[model samples]
Target chain A: MSFSKEITIAKSSVPKVALLVLATIFAFGIFEVGFDQGQLFSIVFGEQAYADLYIHELTHDMRHAAGFPCH
Target chain B: MSLFITIILLSGCSAGVIHGLVNLALVEPYLDKAIGIENQHMFASGEAKDTSQFWAEYYSYRAWQKGGQLLAGAILGTAIGALFGIVFGYAKNILPGNSFAKKALALAAIMWITLYLIPFAKYPANPPTVGDPETILLRQMLYVSFIAISGFGALGFYQVFRRLKSKRFVAVLGYAGFIATVFVVMPQNPDAITAPADLVNGFRAVSLVGVSAFWLSVGLIFGVLWQKLQPDRVKQARFQ
Candidate 1:
């Protein structure tokens, strides 16, 4: 499809996608910090690991909400 | 139920691939760089016949070692984001228009990053014993660049979904799937995880988060710069 059409569609959908991304971030964040389940938390980054894998997931969500793939 | 199961399995596969690459190939070298111990000897330590395990162990160690700042950043980002979401509760407040420019810029950035904007070091750590170090690092750089760029690509995909009649639940599914895969699939134990690191020793803590934060900030900063550089024609379209 034309670039213009994609933009128009993206513009129209921005709010919804952004909202969803925001919600997902919130849900995961709260769960990770508030609950702090040892088994799940440790496993997520790998042993001796300390990353919040959800960062990628949240970025993925941001892409989702933005309306199109980067490529 | 069947469809959900299939989706779950597929998600796991994607995440598993992402996990191995991030930890082993990326994290290992960075940790070694930080501690001045980057080398390929660690990969030779065990039966890590596969490169995947090497990378996973490297990343896990760094992740476990994160300092207080990153922990605070992640926590802060989550809290602030949630508060913003709550304050801007209405759907209308979600996104802006004329997103093409932002997307186009994002695409251009990814492409450029894939080609350039990558990391290099004084010495090769993992410097795989079998392959030439230069060739190994080049291939690793390309792979990581692709993965980083893929982040924007995934977002663009979601944009299309919203344009299509806009199914709320499907979007939610996308988010849930992403979160579950990332949070649950990463390795917890450096030794237990099958991956091996080319680096000589364990790295400082929280290197994983540092890597992502650096990249994400790059995206955000690039996004901001693009927003500034963009002509009024594009910016005006967003509001129209």
Candidate 2:
């Protein structure tokens, strides 16, 4: 497929999708950069890995909220 | 400048969608495989080990749900990384030291790696000091971290590079989009859900460090990779 087509097919996001991602990333960023460091349940044992996972999962949840078709 | 940014964002969204599809089709099975290892370890261990130990007692960790989480993470991260890169690029042209998103990703990644990815400890609730649970936890944590750090890094960076051709929100959308794909496609859950014995007292400083560092690295890798992978369209737009 052409680059545009591939990108469109691979990474297209609706307005809702964008909003969800923005929301989740902001939450994730706030948590990771701020509160996660505290002694509560938010531990950064596997920093990038978990942050990466959090971002990933947050996206997943956000996607579901956005009415996107799941894999 | 506004015209240029609009195209880059479009490219980013397209990249996100593509990433989701790819994860659903190609990467779901591997998640299942990772789950298998985690399951096997949990099953074989009879002593009722602490769930909070942080890593595999033998060498695995997982959930009962399908490999949806990993897929979701992959797709979503790819998009975010791309968006961040493009925004940074755009800012560079507009003003001096204006690379906001790019800086955020880099700082976040490095912070994650340093805080969570290091060799660390997890103390057992009631240690006979025989098995040295801390050591085991460290190894397992490392293994799990490997997946996120490399996966996020590569995927995140790739998205950044694609921002020139598509919608800005597309990359942002991809983070959730790919995750949605994984949630629907995966066949099983990977978590055991029991508390680890190590956490009986609390998450020791060493172990927590490992956790933070791992995620930090994950963010960084994905962030940078996305930045580097932008399409020429994005570059042209950013310069415009």
Cα-based lDDT for every prediction: 0.35, 0.36
lDDT per residue (tens digit) for residues B1-240 in model 2: 333233333433343444344444433344344334444565578535445564453233233122433344344444444344343343333222233335545544533332223212111111111123334334334433433443464357445645646565565456445534533443322222243443312323322332333344434443444345532223211221
Assign candidate 2 its CAPRI class: incorrect
lDDT of 2: 0.36
* Per-residue alpha-carbon lDDT of candidate 1 for residues B23-124, written as tens digits (9 for 90 to 100): 444454543363332233443565344467667865564465333223433443443333232222222223333543344334334332322232211111
| TM-scores for all predictions | 0.27, 0.28
Residue B174 in model 2: shift from native, Å?
34
Kindly give the stretch of ten consecutive residues in candidate 1 chain A with the minimal lDDT sum.
A62-71
> Clash totals for all models, in order?
39, 93
